[model samples]
Target: MTGATRTTEHSAADDDVSRRLLESSATLSYDPMTEIDWEAPLPEDGYGLNPEWSTLYGTPLWDEMTEAQRVTLTRHEVCSIMSTGIWFEMILQQMILRDQYVHNPANAEFQFALTEIADECRHSIMFARTCAKLDVPAYFPRKDVVEAARIFKSVAGGEVAYGGTLVAEEVLDVMQRDWMRGENVLDIVRTSSKIHVVEESRHMKFARQEIREHMEGISPLRRRASAALIALGASVIVRSLVNYGVYRAAGLDTRRAVEAAANNPHRRSMMRTACAGLMEFLDEAGLLTRPAVAIYRRVHMI
Candidate 1:
């Protein structure tokens, strides 16, 4: 087929996907301010997330901790993840805005893109408030990681941008699914996780659609580079999810906690399980290059 015909076909397919996503959003979107009961008192015995999902879970260190210490560590860890969510949401909002710049505002694609951005804005606010309610200190990624993301948010586009977004969303999606169902988890966290899971399901769908669209005509070399870049981004995000400060806040030896977390077999298994679907998707999309797999292995995401 001719180039113009292919372009028209691609545009038509994208419009259909965007239209469905827009309809879905209008049908089921949430306002976290109203949906979450921010004023609810947290139960003293509640975990911030599922204990099995904890980075230190099943380790000897975890066995040595008291119930109160376990609760504190989990709360700090969850807050750290929330802080990282906020950081990446900011990066994604900027990247999406740049990607849609100068595009036809009348198109469904543009409209849905903006809708995703609005969703992310609310998500960040919800996470910030949740952390405050948990009484955990605000956590941030390492300084160099922040600087690298600054460059990424400014220049990354197409499959690289959407792929990274998908990786982050998918990773959190799996964990939040468990969090929302954790009977022992804090009500605030469970409610927030429910809201996030509902909204992020749509965002993940949109990101996957965008990634597929952008990958349609790229060269093999470019695809390889995109794969590596996305893997790098994923590694950074996973590594930063639970800040080292969380250990100190839990009153553990920071060095021991970090080492225990890194070598925790159960935690690595959880990471691998959470990323199974994501790995399948990446492999299908030709983004799971050898280098990308190696990076994913480093983070125990594969």
Candidate 2:
């Protein structure tokens, strides 16, 4: 077969796959009230979550926190981490609406997009309400809004190009879900977790399949894009994990918290544990090309 014919054949194959995905899934809804469970009681002990998470913060930072600070972080930062998942989800929903459904009003993807938008709104509200219950300010600056938009824009390539992002978001979700499951979370938080767990599970599955399919045809330049994105993802993941309050209260330099957290072998290992499985999956899917692995090593290691 000629090169041109091969390229044509590949395009047709990809188009077929995309169509199959859209056709196979049932239509989704935008209704949040009907979808989530709002009455479950919070867990009694969130410490026995994934042992890595317990070990990561259970030592120096957990011990250093004041009762008030502990209450505040538990109420706010703990949930904030989960809420960050919603935050990024909502951003992607908007970006999808902006780019994907702009012309197609009844696009099937729009339904999933709307569901995420509602999910995120409720998650943030519940998080703030829980913070108020503990008298912790649930304020995230508007600048973070800008930052989120910037990152989303930069990463808004096709499903394959943005695969690392999907992996990162879901892993963070696991961390929070496990944490909440271990502790005696507030009623609101417990309820929020029910919604998050269900929705994120579906989202993660969708993203996983989509990413795997998208990675089928990779090129060297796009592979480099994947590499850069994975590196940025590591930075984003670490920064997201490094709580500013944790550093300030621990009497460690807040300025170097990310460096310190990344430098900590245990913490780094924990992060790698969270991400490495997905890394291997991507590698098998041909998503983690040579360039991407090199970039991953550089950012993940000192």
Candidate 3:
């Protein structure tokens, strides 16, 4: 059999996956606007996320913090993560839009790509509302990081684009599972996380399939380059997940909190645990290059 025949069959399988995913989304997609009670009052003691998921969790700083401070810190940390989610969501939307440009609209793949973008737009709005409801200010990635992503999104190929999307989504999938069920968590945050968990499962599936399809028949040099790019993207995302401003908002010394969080063993363990499946996927796709492993380790996502 010729390579062309193999390619055609592979493409068909991708479309089959896309069609199934599209049907699943149409059947189960949610509107956060109506699903959540935006006007509900938050309890004074409620946390924005599971305390265990906090960056400073299990650290000396965490033990020193009062109960009220713990609540405030987790709330700010969760909001900061939401802010980062919005940032990455916008970038992935642009990347997918470009990937599907001028494609056959009748194809299941194209349709699902658009559907994912629409879902991302909604998720961003959902995150924004949760932040506002909690009275948490917008916490942005660094100016340089934002500018770098602006350029990356505008020009990234479908390979790194989908790989990076998978990284971001996979990291959040595990945490959202905990947040949505966390007792004494804020009602708005819990509802928002529940919505995201259900929808993002589909998005992560789509991204993994897309990356697998894109990786097929690529050259070694190209694979290595894509691996490094994806790893770099992950580092940027992990670093920006909880901005330093969150510490200040929780009324701690920013530098000290940052230092403690950076050295927190529990945080490292959680990050590595969260990324295990993503790393396995990347390895199977021939994208777990040595350089990529090094970068993932640096980010403690190995």
Candidate 4:
């Protein structure tokens, strides 16, 4: 055989191995319908929220709604955003998992990502159905440039980006679940939230470990690039909720909601707070290093 032919065959073999790794690790099982007790009663303890939830009350925009409207808004706010966020994230994950199969199919990481893709699908369906049960319509806008960038960056950054995201988000999940410890206002939400928290804990831990491993090998410039991309992805994920039905029911315009949310000082402060907490969490997880920290700080995210 010619040398060129041999090299081509060798490359093909390596590709085959990577593909196999991904496929092998991709199998996972979870039944959304059977996983949570949907009939659970809603807890009454302060509406199952952290005291900081009062921040919503402090906002002039939130005050525009009537008391009954406030109740509807709150319920809609939590379930709708959670549902939408899960839906978008899962869709992105599924795409990424498919790409993994195509690009490096046989790798264990690819396989594991495949399993996660399945989990994300289940989660998206579960959340959508839950929203339907709560009388909220589920809708996702057509993909736009910003959304596309987020999906791309998230997939590119892989486990580390996923982990950093979880660091900011998981604590919110924990806080939400904790609200259910005593009261169950929105029983379905409480139960589903519980299931989510339990499942996401594993994803978060794995992402953190992967990020720590990668950070060691990445140069300072690469780390900054990673941070910026991840942060941009995070920003898009954060901004995608402008079209939620709850905003409509509150007699609010979606565009205005987006604008208000973007320029809101209080929200900015909350963002800083969440990012800071995420940094602390990453540090505790052994991922906070000079380069990573520098990137985060330079971006003014932490």
Candidate 5:
């Protein structure tokens, strides 16, 4: 097809995706402030997440941990993940806001992009409150990683920006699916995960559509390079999800806990399984190149 024809088709597809997503959000988006009981009494026996989802769940270290220690560790871990989610949501909000600058405001694409930014703002606030309610201080990514992402979020655009957004959403989506359903999990976590899962489903779809639009006419060389860049972003996100401070906060030896979590086969399996659908989507979008796959393998995301 002609270049003009392809551009027209892309616009049509983008419009259709954005319109449907807007409709979905209007029908079912959440306001966590009113939804969660901020003052509810905490169940002393509830866990922050499913035990199976814990990084050190199957390790010998986990076996040695007292039940109380296990509970503390998981609380710190989930709060750490929420903190990371806040960081990433803020980053993507900036990227999307930047990308939409001076665009045709009448288009559904522009409107949905703004809507996503609004949603992410709310999501970040929700995460922050959850951490506060749990009495867990926010765990930030390493200083250098934060500095690096500062540069990336400011400069990233097009497929690379949308691709990174999709990777983060997809990674979190699979785990939150489990968290939302874990019967023994904390009510706070379960309800928040439910809200996140429902809303982020639309964000993931919007991102996939955005990435497809960006990829439509780019050259193969640029496509491969974009794949590698997005993979690198994914590596940063995976590494930052669980901060080392969490172990210290949980009263475990930071080094030992980190080592155990790093080597846990069960955790690796969980990551790989969580990423399978994401990997398929990336592969179909031609963003899962050899170099990208290699990067994902290093993080056990493949």
Candidate 6:
């Protein structure tokens, strides 16, 4: 087939996918403001997320903590993750906007891209409100990581942008599926998680579609480089999910808590489980190069 014919076919397929996504959004999108009971009081015994999903869970340090301390620690950890969520959501919004710039707005793909942006805007606000209701202070990634992300959001595109997005969303989706169902977790967190999981599922699907489209006919060297970049992005995100301040907030020694969390076998296992589908997807997309695998292994995400 001629190059123009191939390009037209690809565009048509993308439009079909976007049309379906738009239909899905119109049928079942949410309004977090009304979906969440922002006024409800948090139970003293409630956890911020499922205990099994905690970074320190199953560690000796976790075992040593009192019930109240555990509750506090988990709350801070969840809020920390939510803060990271907000940060990445902003980066993604910028990346999407840039990607769509000068594109045909009449196309379904462009309209759905804007719709996804709208969903992320709502998600960021929902996460911020959830953290405020949990009474936890804002948590940020390291100074260097923050600076690096600023650079990344400015130039990242194609597979790297969508791959990083899919990785983050997939990792969180696995955890939130449990959080939304955790009977011992706070009702506010559960409601918020439910909203996030539902909305982000569609986003993940869209990212996967975008990544596949962008990977077409790319060179091996570029593919490897993109894989490494995406893996690096995932490592930064995973490392920042639970800030060290969370340990101090629970009145534990930061050094010890960090050490324990780093070596916790169960926590590593949880990460591997959470990222199983993501790993498979990356592998299928030819984005799981040797270097990328090493990076994922360092974060226990493989």
For model 3, how does the per-residue alpha-carbon lDDT over 140-258 read when each residue is reduced to its tens digit? 99999999999888778667888889999999988988999998888888888899999999998888888888877878888898999999999999999999988998889899999
Off by over 4 Å in 6: 1-10
- Cα lDDT tens digits, model 4, 194-287, are 6666555545554554455445544656655666555554545545543455567656676665455555566556546656666676666445
CA displacement after TM-score superposition, residue 36 of candidate 6 (Å):
0.9
Residues 86-157, candidate 1, lDDT per residue (tens digit)?
Answer: 999999999888788777788898899999999999999999999999988889999999998998888888
Q: Model 2, range 147-245, lDDT digits (tens) per residue? A: 865766544655432464466565666565665465454545554565566555555655565455445566767656765665565555545533455
Candidate 2 local distance difference test against the native: 0.51
Stretches > 4 Å off in candidate 5: 1-10
lDDT of 6 by residue, 1-302 (tens): 11112232336778888999999999988899999998988889999999998888998888899999999999999999999999999999898888777777889988999999999999999999999999899999999999999989888888898888998899999999999999999998898899888888888988999888888888999899999999999999999999999989999999999999999999999999999999999999999999999999999998
Candidate 2, TM-score vs. the true structure? 0.67
Q: lDDT per residue, candidate 5, 131-194, as tens digits?
A: 8988999899999999999999878888899899998999999999999999989999999999
Local accuracy by lDDT, each model: 0.91, 0.51, 0.89, 0.53, 0.89, 0.90
TM-score of every candidate relative to the true structure = 0.96, 0.67, 0.96, 0.67, 0.96, 0.96
Cα lDDT, model 1, residue 47: 99
Off by over 4 Å in 2: 1-72, 102-110, 139-155, 216-218, 246-262, 294-302
Poorest 10 consecutive residues of model 5 by lDDT? Answer: 1-10
Over the full model, what C-alpha lDDT does candidate 5 score relative to the true structure? Answer: 0.89
Error of 6 at 192 (Å): 0.6
Name the top lDDT candidate. Answer: 1
